[model samples]
Target: MKKTTINYLHVGYWLLVLVQTLLVSLGTGVLGTTFDWRLFSQIVLPVKFLQVLSSAIFFYINYLFLIPVFLKKGNVIKYLPSLIATLLIFTPLYYFLEQRLYPMIGWKSYDADLNFWFAVMITLSSNFINIFLAILLSYLMDWRTMRIQKEIIEKEQFKTELAFLKSQVNPHYLFNTINDIYALTQQQSAEAPNALLKLSELLRYMLRESDDQFVPLSKEIIYLENVIELQKIGQKGLSFVNFEVVGEVNKLKIAPLILINFVENAFKHGTFNKKNNPINILIIIHEQLLHFQISNQINHVKKDKTGGIGLVNVKRRLSLIYPEKHELTIHQLENEFIVDLKIALYD
Candidate 1:
């Protein structure tokens, strides 16, 4: 809620309390007598006004000072003693204004009709209710404020994690692409110029379009196609790479750079030994869900321990952004490594 709205609500609440206090004081009469203008102006208004003033004082004391200082800090020992002392001090003050001050203003005091101990107990009981209500209100407001702050902190953390994951992905992809371009240049292949052009387009997409939290599925697919084209430029004539998109991808949206890591990993490990087996990639979108599968022949002897950072970073990003909305499975067989990922987009 807006701060101004909260402030208006607070003002409304105090106005309501003031109105109710005025009605009770002006109607029925506190001294158990019929409504009389003279008595009201002389006795009831002054007496009830003083009582309401005392209630407001005690309420604010508990709400603004005592609750935050002692009760909120879990210092019950000090809280109880301080509360009792405040009530004891204020109860007598309320009694004096209602009893002793009446006679000084040329009106009969009610003290002669009631026992001293009974009056003191009655005053304390009434003040206790006001103070307790104030404490409860303070606690509820504090809890609400804490809850809002916690949500804000969690949102900031999520953004930071996403940025860190994207940073890792950018460097990893650029490093591998540069190596590919360098290899072509060393061989003095004519494909070097064309490969550099594809690299420029890929870099433009990464820098401009992929900055959003979610991008159109079509754009992601195009990016994957570009990556495959770039990777294929340096491959041998007998190497095989196939990419297929199976359902509609018109308006579907997904996290940027999520699927490329798996494709990168496939090419990195699948062709390490120059095997003739094909690397397969399939993406299907149906019923507001996306299913992606990739499989490749593994060269276990050429595996590097630190080369799995792309996969690790993608997994962490998936967990943070999608949480229970996505599922991932990996399988390693004697000759092939496979990955299956499913994500629900309706939510």
Candidate 2:
């Protein structure tokens, strides 16, 4: 995951390998009964040094060269033949060097009683196990790298999709609000100038602030208030909009433009020619929980496809950003449409 952590793991693994190698080499009576510093320095150390060097060479050949070139490419045909040829060439050369070097170090031959072919076979078998372990370790490292890469790609894709969803909200909302402003201008109402100012502020919020992954809850509330004001200007008669905030929204942050979708949907489908139809929106924060609810009397008979698309986009955004931390529920009663949403803000 982190470079320092990976370095530590590599250090630990090599230390373990070194300890195992030391135990294998020193466990035998090659150094004799008493521990002699001169004997260790002169003979035993040299023999062990040679052994480690040979093993390291073989190990790296498989780890660095063979595994990446052949095994990673899935070229079993070439991989097997290459391994066999390496063993064939290395076995005799290793045996010949050991034969010449052992006597000089006062090293007794364990394979002296055995035939040459048997000794060669034994060396080949041991070297094969070493190479196999090296290859296995290489595979494990490659797999870890691939898994980390996959997670990074998935996270980037999720952010891209969420941005796309957020972008959709701005254009759709601007279209509706512009229509409301146009209606007011046609009527030549005194509220048209105020509505245009509110529209500009709302546009500034959407264009500038909504680009962030999260925004202040207070700011979002102000945007909603502007939307409600714009909607009120276009409609006449008794006021049927009710918005209430029930907690101290000091440092709270939420996904930008998330709460506005439900309010827009309510206003689009809830209003009627009669003054009886009303839209109610409520927001409350208690501890780490943020709760939002919206309900409106449904006056329209047929459902618009655009509203459905907006809802789908919001749902997708919520799932991507909050996942298990948020719950959203929509209900349609006899004459009312309701949305209840709860979000865990701490995480």
Candidate 3:
């Protein structure tokens, strides 16, 4: 409980008990004296104060020690006995301090003589109320604590999944680059050194930024440029390329490796030039949106090399990360293929 709430509840409870005691005292006025402020301030105040203090102390001890011990031992039935013991321990301490000790200290007693049965009944009722409230409070505390634990576990699981996904991107990109290098080496061309250097630069990016989930848009563009340069080395004079970046390059950030796959797919499947259509790519940032377009010519009838799987993976990732925040389009017009993508940027 918040300290303020506990304090209010503590005071409110005792005030209720004091009012009950006053009513009882007033109801018995016919047998003795009537309700008087002088008597209350001098006698009733001292008794009420002692009763509240003793009750509070006993309640604290019972909840802090007795209840936990009972729960730990799985002794639900022992709660009644524990409550009885707590009352037995506190009642005398309060009665003795108010009636006996205060008398010695020159404080008048708000004393009443009743049949033993009535006192016993009052004590039993008080014990019942205490036990009921304590159980309810403890259950609320346990429930709130358990809810917080569940939230922590869910957050941790999400972090683990994100880390796994991030790790997967690095190796997947590296494997594709390695395959490119192998193809170039098999040809035994003069461009092999340049290809190796490009591979080294790509490896450097993977090592330095692999652990990062997000990178500057400019860094990704530079990496894509390196890949394109490396691909050009093997193409010799046979390949024609048209690359354009429109608009100013400002402080924009995006998920790493998101655009690379489209670039890679274009180069892998659309290299032939029968229709005079070479690889064309456009990447621009305008009004806080990343606009990308890539198209290449497909001359021969390839056997659905994509198999409708790789792009599916990208779509799944976009849904998981961006949901309704992105747009993508694909078209295959005779010998020409095209992909268009647009994503919002934060900066």
On TM-score, the leading prediction is 2
Query: Can you give the lDDT of residue 7 in candidate 3?
Result: 72
User: Please, what is the TM-score per model?
Assistant: 0.74, 0.80, 0.64
Instruction: Show how many residue pairs clash in every candidate, following the order shown.
Output: 0, 0, 0
Model 3 residue 201 distance off true place after TM-score fit, in angstroms: 2.5
**What is the TM-score of candidate 3?**
0.64
Ranked candidates (lDDT, high to low): 1, 2, 3
Candidate 3 residue lDDT tens string, 1-347: 46698679867976897777666756866225655677667765666566556655666666677787885468878966886776776656655664577777455444674344454455556556666576677777789878878988977875676555544453454566567667767887666777788778877876687557678888888888887876666455566678899976658877776777677677667764433667888998897888999999864565455444456656666655566889999998877789999888766
Model 3 poorest 10 in a row by lDDT: 113-122
- Cα displacement (Å) at residue 68, model 2: 4.1
Residue lDDT tens for model 2, 1-347: 68899779866765676667656656775556767788777876666666656666777787888878998899989988888777767776667556777666786457564456766686676676787788888988889989999999998998889878887774666777688778878989787789899999998998899988888888999999998887777665344788899987877888889988888888777764355567888999987689999998886675575566678888898888788999999999988899999987742
Model 3 clash count equals 0
Clashing pairs in 3: none
User: What is each predicted model's overall lDDT from 0 to 1?
Assistant: 0.80, 0.79, 0.69
Over 4 Å off in model 2, which ranges?
2-12, 26-46, 71-75, 101-119, 179-197, 234-239, 272-277, 301-306
Provide the lDDT at 138 for model 3: 72
User: lDDT, candidate 3, residue 236?
Assistant: 53
For candidate 1, lDDT tens digit of each residue in 123-154?
A: 67767677778878897888989999999999
